[model samples]
Target chain A: MKITNVKSYLVEDIVKPFTWQVDRPGSGDGRDPRKNFSCVMVLDTDEGISGYAKGPKGRIMMDLVERRFSSDLIGMNPLNSEKIWEKCWDTDRLEEYPLYAMAMVDIAVWDIKGKKAGLPVYKLLGGYRDEIPAYASTTSYDTLEEYRDVVEASLSAGYPSIKLHLRYRDVKTNAKLCEKVREWVGDDFSLTLDASGLWNYTDSLWFGRVLEELKFEWYEEPMREFELESYKKLCDKLDIPILAAECSDGSHWNAAEFIRRDACDIMRTSTHYKGGFTGGMKVGHVAEAFGMKAEVHGGGHNNLHLCLALPNNTYYEDLVIDVEDIEAKGQGQLKFENGMYSFKEQVAGVGIEYDHDELETISIQKYEKF
Target chain B: MKITNVKSYLVEDIVKPFTWQVDRPGSGDGRDPRKNFSCVMVLDTDEGISGYAKGPKGRIMMDLVERRFSSDLIGMNPLNSEKIWEKCWDTDRLEEYPLYAMAMVDIAVWDIKGKKAGLPVYKLLGGYRDEIPAYASTTSYDTLEEYRDVVEASLSAGYPSIKLHLRYRDVKTNAKLCEKVREWVGDDFSLTLDASGLWNYTDSLWFGRVLEELKFEWYEEPMREFELESYKKLCDKLDIPILAAECSDGSHWNAAEFIRRDACDIMRTSTHYKGGFTGGMKVGHVAEAFGMKAEVHGGGHNNLHLCLALPNNTYYEDLVIDVEDIEAKGQGQLKFENGMYSFKEQVAGVGIEYDHDELETISIQKYEKF
Candidate 1:
């Protein structure tokens, strides 16, 4: 019942090199596909129910838990998720910050809770639906033809929707690309655009109008998340649902300001950024109270289960290269069948099993604290 | 020039037991005289001009540096104060948070800068003033007479001003105590009230009115710092200046929102909370651009020098005990005379020299990472 120890493993190249048809807008600018790494955290408890979670980029988060958070967690009951989350916030007193570290521990604690209860994390959380619709969250691409091909392939593979991480720089060119994707997918398929907070107010407005014309489902992170006045203006001027507050300052309390200001249509909450699942749940509740949908920022089994628990969230953004490619690489990646993703029935907690052999091979460093 | 190793020394009871006439407003309710602990950090560079700082609440922060931050610092240049501060921010991506840990290192970096330049830290920070007026920041008292006596004693001691950390509950009693102190201190003597964020909207309004009637200098932390709407209302309605945004979510950018909302008259920025001297300086600059005064929350030679470097800051709230009491315990405390405190000519960097014997006696934990 007590958290006895916490271990962090830094795994490198766990993910195979996968290229986006379009370059990731405004980052690395023509460099090779940036490699992927995992910081895996395993929480060991006295009662023999170990919890697991993925930490932030390697040694940083692992060191955070061991040095700063371990003492607080060591003697406490693993079920006290709320207290553990609050302790992480109080440790720094920075408005529920150090969220990356908090999430690693919190997700693990939740994993413990699910395991102890003999229920999936989703069932423990309110389990609104057994399955949620999956949308293909596409990476950026170079040409319109590439985007068109990807969308066509995704639709052909039975994905109900696609969300684009569009190109940076030119608003007109990005708008043209969105139009091409919309035309390629046709009217029945849902499409959304994530510009990665690339545009300013005027450009965001210009591009938003284009999405509105094409009946795109939503336009996400069009402007800086903190630009409340601009977000309000964009929300007023545009017809597309604005998904924002993804990387809010600290806790959900910080994100609530966006809702308070009437800034965006859909609120973005995640275990990674908004403290952890505890923080994410609070954000979802806050958005729900305002009659707004709180969208999980990206896809993962953890996020999908959280979506299932919260009635307010509507879709799962299944992130990938191609389903076959991910499955081929094996171990860490989830298997996608026609875009629907779920945890195995026997898999409790976060439910995603680590490929231990692959994890060990890629691991560059490891730290354990009790 | 490169940081070779980082050492954290956890010193216990370095601060002597000094009781306030009353308790601190809302914290440590009814506990015995609180023990003082120091988390001292020493940044050893390859070139041998080392830097030092005191971190947040004992071993917690010291361990943070040893376990998480040392690796990042080992090969880093001590002169890259700005870059070092940013890297700390990037470590968590929590809005330049974990300020407590960052401050401990940054103060040392600034110290290094001052030593390397053979100029005091203030001179490096733009040296707006060689000396700053020190105000007696009083702890809570049990009775109005105790407060009246303390104010009278502080004034008689040649202090220019006194700020009160008033009782936790009962707005009316706190207002009455404020009125009594104001009447006793008479006109032209500055008095500020720190309610310790003990009041809500109505009570804050009620007590703020009393301070206004008495011509108090400022009201500090009347309500929760995050209550932007309440702060805006309080600022608009009250004649006395509202000092707030002390522990904002992410560095000063989070605090800047208070200015953007026109929420408070004076801004609170400190090395401990606003990342470090680097972040504190940024907050000070932001407040300066708005034509508002940014006040350092507490006194320390480190903070005083930071204040001296920033033009917008006006005074230092010398915290906890009388300067004499502070100096009596030894090492890090500054000397105060005739309402002013300044660094000694020989004191370089942060200008604080540890009482090595006292530090050694109190040392309970030590961590070093290279």
Candidate 2:
């Protein structure tokens, strides 16, 4: 079906305060984490089927999508998803990373694909599994006791695995904190660490040794993603599966280089940062060919479906500041039971139908032509 | 002064038909060139002083500039050109190709910089020289005779150099045409060739040997820009300086890799294609540091000013289907003198004050909020 219009709306009321170890001082870009808001992108077709996807920090994404993507997307057929994805990528001259707007449009287009087929997007994505284990990716805490308490609480709350978003500035302290969380959870529970690329080679080397001794499951972005030399060196030494490619802008073609180089043990990707379903799947497929696991970063129905579709990905990251905030904002039907999260078989499209009343809580920032 | 707003208007009546060797059948994207339009980008400030820049293909650029750039730019100082440039680049996750809207904003910001300082943008851009040799970069002609006549016409028109945009499908014919144009212009006249990357290594290798034998001035995008191996191999085999990286997305950092790898002998960059004055200058500065030339691609007041500012660039490319089309479309004030083109230094900004009467002839497609 021919697309009629593409519009983006900024919803500010639902902004959730966030802090990550990667966002702390000295983290690259030095951008302290702020309250994250949602920018919902809607693609309307002449056939009367409309698909929408939500992204964090809607303010920035909305502008890029409207300005860069609308004109290219407005008149094309929604079913030509591959061509549309390529058009968006080529329009920006195929940057190293994926455009959030393009990725969101890809999700919206997949939503349209599912709606037309009378199935959920995951099914369209090959439906490898209906469920996967979910890990609690927590925010960085100030004290060692805080890390221990958070780990214990997550275990009590039925999370079998919990990833530590450690204080990156003090690697010694972060290493001690990782040890404390592991001691609290013991060896049976899944423990992972995300340094958020805050460490240099020395710090990463020092902390990676501690994680290796502790037998942590995976270490994500312990050093800068661009520091390929450091990543190669670190991956060589660490027994823990070193995950990367989260910083790979969005092209799987670029991701393929990392795969070829033996850069990391696990590949990190998601729908928001990668180009969309088509792009995300491309990266996933590449990872599969290389005999490596592609960990889908970020949590959403789209991500969950992607994880389900790809046989290589191990877990879906359920990132939360507080588990209660999930219900406070009406994010979606993200059901968590006994350390795993799964979708409730969405009947049509992406299946995230925002509550009308909740949507009314936030002001409709702007809506205009293609 | 704070930027009050950022607005873009699409001037539709002035679309020029262009076909590069890159747009030919089996050459990459395979989309034939159409009548290209211009998008005029204006960055207005609180003090009532405004800066503007023009780019080809207004429909896509207009939407992006208005939607993505306006919000981040509106309340910021126009003098924070570097910061504005980085903000735009980071917002899009820093694509490899220049963000056209960001580059235009950079031009407009520089326009404001010049206006505020009451100097031409070229003067502010180091004012390396007042005059640079002008070359006639022509469209593809059907036959060799048509190409010969155009070279004669351009030479008769007082242009010092001519770059042949040759038919790339047949390397033998293209090589013959290059030799023909060199003979037609004689050994003293500057003769360059742009294949728009229509050749593979075998064709480029075969064609490059011919250009070497003929002693052509420069070979532009003789092969794929991304094929580093092909570029390196070609550059090693050919004596003529291989001009490349015109397709380097938009970041100078990525362009730096090409220089580090010795992929091309000459660098190809432009204002709108390279992320505006700030981003384009960064690439040029890197080229300067590397002891190589940064040849600004495309033609407009923005590129002309950039060429005037840079020490390494040898000529300004004046691309046109017909010389009259340049004046007819009111593109810029490019005065052709004895074998050169130069601007009668305007009072301030980019110095291209569009003829108010000529602007009246085209429709102002859209004007709205940042």
Candidate 3:
């Protein structure tokens, strides 16, 4: 199939609120409204099928690809998504770069291609499964009440487990939150503590000790993502497994070195940011070879498509998008039943259905590629 | 100081085509056009001031930043350019991020800010230089004829000295390029060589022996930018100093650490891809603090803003953008004279004026900022 149009919609309503340790938090040094937003790209094919890619940071990346690399895909056989991804990536074309945007778009396009071909996204990725387990990850919170509500909400919403966003607050608040949540959920449920790099070794250690007393599943990002030596040291100091790195740059070398050095126990396998499904798949292969936990980092629908089809990844991060919050539509949004989610067996893309109204609301703009 | 608008222009033309070895020259990858192109970004402020930024893989990085960050700067205070850069970077709201795009935008904004404030960009960074010196970096072929022509061009153009881009050719080529040019200039001329990660341990040792014959100033990037131990070994084995970096990620700590450990002689600086100006300034500061050569890498009108302002950066690279390549207004463009160039005195904002036609050609169709 030949690709026809690559269009971007800037959703006015779906905003992802900022929760960065984004400049030491509350410093007034941070302000990005886009932090609370989503930008979607729809790539239409001449065969009457379309691909939808949800770029983490909006219209720019997808929009640019539409303008620049459009010709690379347009009129070319659309089934060769992986080959096309490689072409876009290998085209360094700059003295230095952000090749990742091209990557995210490529995968999204692949998802669409798979659907059009009447196959699953992961099947094209060498399908390792028909479904995968999931963990509901709370996006953000400001108080204990917020944490409790999210925790209790995730449980009732049928997540096999729950992950917390811990940062910028007092150590006592974290210690207390973990202890209280564990008491509320009991030892039978899986509980994970994600600090998201807001802590130093001392902070991670303090929380690690308390989480141990409460028997938390793992401590995510005890230190910064690349603090390999510290991560290794902390792994030795605490009995709990440390899961990290959704934002580490460098290469698989960064992750490989961490594992080779015994720095982490549970590994976060990410597409787009790290490497796309191909990169993430390779990371999964490495983690499994090393016997590390491989979980999908949050907010990647393209990844969840592959995750559901992979076995090495038993835990998928469920970014409970308030779907109703925005008019986003797709035919492949995965379904959750009794804390378990699976592909719909349509073999047509990810199977998340699309909403036409949501699609109509986003701003459509053209970027110059030639 | 209010940035009423953030106008971004994608510059696809190469002032001078750059050549570098990729896929080892004879590899089948040579047929790839993606490997052959270069892109640059010019950020113009609403107040008739402009800052030029070279992106990470120029076009891609430029697109990513312009897509996500441009809208933010539309009504922002240009005075807080650095602060804005940190926000986009720290939060990382976008996907495929090393987020170098944000950094590129940040740098150009600062240059624009400096020009608007009637100071050199580096002066806004604290008046580190009243005037700076430069090195003539020739990108001509290694063949004797081309080398002779370019060196003569550089000399007639009146640079205090020159640096050779060495690789795939030989010591003989460098000798021919430098010694002949030196002899032609009659002895007082200085020279350096960029091995461009071409020489290894033994190769460096061999080059060291041969280099003394010509009395080259320092060998640049004699090995890979990160090969600290090898560099240390090479440095110990040679009498001549070694210059390293320029082609690097901002977080090449191992390289900096190696320099900290006395691995090489100079710290080569580049503002294009890493963190744009802010990141370059950080690296420059690190080099200054460590008493290493803050040799400015890459050449351009934008670079002129950097080179003329940093005292610690005694030498600027010659990445030329001919007057014909520049579409900006006025006689503010640079011209080589007496082996030196002067920063315009008391001129406000990045000094270069934009061509209204070029501006209209790349103007935004629409923009809104919070």
Candidate 4:
């Protein structure tokens, strides 16, 4: 069916704020918590079906959609996702359309396609599995003790593995913490590290050596994504799989470079950052072709769909900040039980739930284009 | 239909040999002409339909199919091209299956798929056009006068554009020749240069500046394909489109790296070097996504199908070693008339004509696996 209208809602304070512990001394007391706002987009079609997705949480994302994409999206068939994706990328050389904006449109269009086909998004993408093991991915915390407690709590809450996002600048302390946590979690537990693209070559080497000794599952983004040469060196010097290209610009295109250079062992992909399912799957297939894995970067219904569909992807990431907050919110349709995340059976589309009343009350701005 | 058997034939002296002019001192009189042998691959299915494709011209390609790939092909469905392609790449990390070997299987599979569907391969690939403009691509020649004669002959033979494969090591002489040819052809005719990945960085820059001044359509592989950083610098320095990654490994993956780094303005792709139709299409889509052209690298029925199917690819290449030779062996099925290559209407599969009696006469080795 043809898309009749495109709508975006800028909602405030819908998600709980989450903070990251600071590593650099003068970079403020701690990293600011994520803004508890979201840009929710909806595409209304002539068949009376609406597709929904969450875009990057801000006015900028909404403004980009309204000014640059909404008009172009009108009168297009939602089922022609590839054509629409190409249309959006037609101006990429100059516009450099942010991944999130493209992701929002593509994800919404796939949602419409799935609903029409009477299948979930993952099935439409060629499903690999209904359940996937999940890792507890954490925001950086202040102390070693805090890390230990979160690791214990994550295990108790049914997570099979955990990935530590440690203080950016303090390599030594992070290494020590990794060693201590490995001891606490014991030998069989799957533990990995995400340095958040913060280390220099020498520092990354030093830190990577420690991870190797500790038998960490993977060493992630120790250097900035653009430092491909450095990443190549790291891959050569260290045995640990280097997971990279999480926030890099060119999506599958950039990920292909990392693979070609032997720079990254695991590729980071998400509907939120990699132009939704279409771009994410391309990266996944490219990695798979090279005998590498493309890991889902975040925890959400969209990412859950991807984790299920991608054969090369091993684990779904369940973001854990405060244990209490995670317990209260509860993971949506993707239920975590027995240390695995499983999709609810027979659900069509992306299977994301929307609270219309909450969305209406929290929306600060609404834009509709026909 | 289930693939029942895979067969390979090594046939000798099936093609006319053509020489390449040498550029470096003591590199021998001229580069040895291409071997006159060819490896023909056929996939026999249970449904009594057989698919055909020409592999890289040698016994090694036949050996690769027999020793590594034939067993895997026995029970596969020929229509499941993507699955078979992925199965081949399953060992890419260690085995590093050469592009031509993979291309042979993929192209043969597509042939079976198209014949089964009663359509041309281009139509199965989502047909973009029935015809594409053709460029006469010349082999390197010793003298400037010989190059001038070939360019004149190509124009008379219904070619609108011509790409010069020039003496690689002599940049100054090549530059002078480019200027002379441009002046002879006038400003409107499309003239481009291919250096065959021979120049060093400094020489590449100097030659590129001359090409830019002469307004060549593109400067191709001025430096080695592995020297990506040098290509990136050349792209930044030259305003003319840089066509690259023609002989590079990794197919769409490597092509993606060039696009991501802005190393080339146009990408070089062909079924013979990329992984056949599937791989060529992926590279085409990747370039299209970035608003770049993916030029077909060589001439043949396979490359012709790609030129018609890919929206961003502009011209089909018609390799012209000598005017007399090309005139005697006219392009097959893909007719070149009035400056364009057009496919025959209602032809199924790749529409390649094979002389079975000649193949039998020239066959030196035959292999079959069931």
Q: Which prediction has the highest lDDT against the true structure?
A: 4
TM-score of 3: 0.73
lDDT of 4: 0.78
CAPRI verdict (incorrect, acceptable, medium, high) for model 2: incorrect
Query: For candidate 2, lDDT tens digit of each residue in B137-220?
Result: 888877777777677778877777888887557887777788788788888877788887676788888887787777778888
- Model 2: per-residue lDDT, tens digit, A174-292? 77777777778888888888877676788888888888899889888876554455677888887888998785553586576566556788988788667788888888888889888
lDDT of each: 0.72, 0.72, 0.60, 0.78
By DockQ rank, best first, the candidates go 3, 1, 2, 4
A76-157: candidate 4 lDDT, tens digit per residue: 9999999888667543322334577788889999999998988999999969998999888887777878777788888888
Task: Using DockQ, give the best candidate's number.
Answer: 3
10 residues in a row with least lDDT, candidate 3 chain B? B22-31
Worst lDDT run of 10 residues, candidate 1 chain B, spans B23-32
Error of 2 at A182 (Å): 6.2
| TM-score for each candidate, following the candidate numbering | 0.74, 0.74, 0.73, 0.54
lDDT of 1 by residue, A149-242 (tens): 6676777667788888764468888877877777787887788888766768999998888888999888898865656767988998877899
DockQ-derived CAPRI band for the predicted complex in model 3:
incorrect
Question: Candidate 1 DockQ category?
Answer: incorrect
Give a tens-digit lDDT track for model 4, residues B1-370: 8999888888654344544535221211111233344679888999988899986534546646765568668899998999998767543322334577789899999999988998999999969999888888887777888888888888888788989887546777887888899988889999888887666889999988898899989989876565566788888988888999887666787777688778899999889778899999998989999999999888888988999999999988888877785574355566777888877567789887566667677788888885
TM-score (chain A only) of candidate 4: 0.94
